[model samples]
Target: MTTAYYVHVTIDQGKNVMLLDSGCTQSAFPLKEFQKLLFQFGTQKISHQFIIADIDNAILLRLDFFENHHCLLDFQNAQLKIRDSAVRCCDSQGNLLKVNVQVRQDTVLPPRTERFSMARLSTKWVQGTACIEPADTVPGVLVATTVQDPDKQQVHLRLMNYTDREIRIPAGKIVAMCLAANLTRPAPTESASHGQLPEHLKTLVEESCQGFSPEEKPKVQALITEHQNAFSSSQYDFSKTNVIKHGIPLVPGAKPLKQRPYRHGTAQEAEIEKQGQSLIREGHGA
Candidate 1:
């Protein structure tokens, strides 16, 4: 897919969408698209294809290459067909309705700061839709797959800018096929699940106020429900942000020792990431 407008990025592009930029052209990939393509076909690697500027194209379908390779392109109708019988799966992809994610505010995603925002889409839906993973679609940014609001049709996106410079996303620009797929109805909120208190909250209340009188149970439950966010789920959670931090102090002029990063394979990496993410998600860590 190719975006209509050109983007200028500061840092080197990510691994998935590598580009070999020269002249006025560059090759880009994965995309601002729902349907993505990753090929790297053909055992022959050209002397070119370096890590280059990421533009709006996933496939660089140059006219000269088709002419040189004796392959024909239907330029008039704008279609390409491979006659090889081995290539069977290409034709199986059916029609798709690409959804456009529009921003409410002109978002400026700074490289070092985390950005989280809500924006509505063109199509209104009763359920959440997953983001298409904006790879090189909008240059250095990637919009995370998140649940959308059913009523407002609002989408929560965690915008990450891998580039050095800030990426300015205007209020009404659509990056090519920036698409989304509708997901199943999101899980009910706390009030929707039960009457008021969720199962966990009820359990917490029962466990904490077991010794309280029957007359005070309702009041206690109400108090706990109102302050539920301050409640910790486990030993690891310490998220009462207003509370003054208390930690053991070191003597004056004591230099903190540098700790080596924990090394584990992909499994540990994923777990560590999840741990860090959960902190941010729950508003425990900034």
Candidate 2:
């Protein structure tokens, strides 16, 4: 009989939250969220080899080395400067259809306008199609990106004016929703059954362990020996204890103390009492 062990890990990269799935043959990420990491994907060949689709039909991409990684989100697009202008359309007889390009007075343009806003994305694959939408319910339109030219960071976006009123897109507005089609493939495996780790991965794990320092090797071995039961056993018992009842002890002779009235305080008190007696003789206590 073989005992299978699985562990769950929560990965948070800025606003992105992902989980470590053991049943999943490979790891996966949302394209929009993936772009926010300080990591880059490897060439498609290496990626395609390791990142196959899981049973759920989601394609899993593995992370390459973590060095000199770059984020793909467009922080500059948080606030875009919208300038107002007029576009004149003339009829055959030079009759102009004048529509003022309405710009909101509160709208502020960025200092530089020669270059349009662009969005960068990251992926291990050479090229693939993705669906881009607006994050919020707004009039901002996506100019769109080509699935053919998803170079390292060449994905650019253009905003189209859909509404008649020229308005300002406030800063920090999340306006891009990009999603890639589900890449489906078989999970990496050596045999049909699921209890064993992939052969390639087993080799890599062995190599990694072999490369550990001499002092660290014993620590790793100790951890494995200590947690051997966790890997070999499938049953876990969590018997609840009578926590509240057993927490504090009841003392038999406990009693509440009573307050006492003021008595002898000082010589000043005795002198005051004598003065009070004299005053009472005179029919006055003050």
User: Which 10 consecutive residues of model 1 have the lowest summed lDDT?
Assistant: 85-94
Alpha-carbon error at 281 in model 2, in Å? Answer: 99
- TM-score for every candidate vs. truth? 0.31, 0.22
Best by lDDT: 1
Off by over 4 Å in 1: 1-97, 126-135, 175-286
Task: State the C-alpha lDDT per candidate.
Answer: 0.49, 0.36
True lDDT of residue 192, candidate 1: 40
Q: How far is candidate 2 from the true structure (C-alpha RMSD, Å)?
A: 30.8
As for candidate 2, its clashing pairs are 81-109
Best by TM-score: 1
Cα distance off (Å), candidate 2, residue 5:
21
Which lDDT value does model 2 have at 216?
86
Q: lDDT tens string, model 1, 78-167?
A: 223223311101111211133456667798988845588666666544323444443335777766654443347556667777666988
How many residue pairs clash in all the candidates, one count each?
Answer: 0, 1
